[model samples]
Target: MSEAAKELNDIKRLMMLLLLKLGASPDEIALALQVDASLIRKTIPSRKVKKIVSEKG
Candidate 1:
């Protein structure tokens, strides 16, 4: 990918992490970003998800 696209994707991932920390559901995040929820689930690290789930739970 081009540098700009890579940067944008990195920014998206960071936003995804922040949203997860804020307790936004995967589906909600996908909807907000106009992408599929499964894409988010697949892209995000399980460690991050576990951390958020543990913190929220």
Candidate 2:
């Protein structure tokens, strides 16, 4: 993937992980991440979710 696309994907993944850890609803996370909730849900990993959330907090 192009560098810009890769960066965007990484940001999206991190946002999803953060949202999941924060216990933010999918819709809320999507809004915060400026993307669709389904996309975030699909991209984020369950294992890393908590880590991202905690780090953000």
On lDDT, the leading prediction is 1
lDDT scores of the candidates, listed in order: 0.80, 0.67
**Candidate 1: residue 4 lDDT (0-100):** 100
lDDT of 1 by residue, 1-57 (tens): 899999999998988888887677789988988999899889885355634445533
Which ranges in model 1 have alpha carbons more than 4 Å from their true place?
45-47, 50-57
RMSD of 1: 3.0
Worst 10 residues of 2 by lDDT: 48-57
Q: Candidate 1: global Cα-lDDT? A: 0.80
RMSD of each: 3.0, 4.7
**Candidate 1 clashing pairs?**
none
Candidate 1, residue 25: lDDT: 79
Candidate 2 Cα outliers beyond 4 Å, as residue runs: 32-36, 45-57
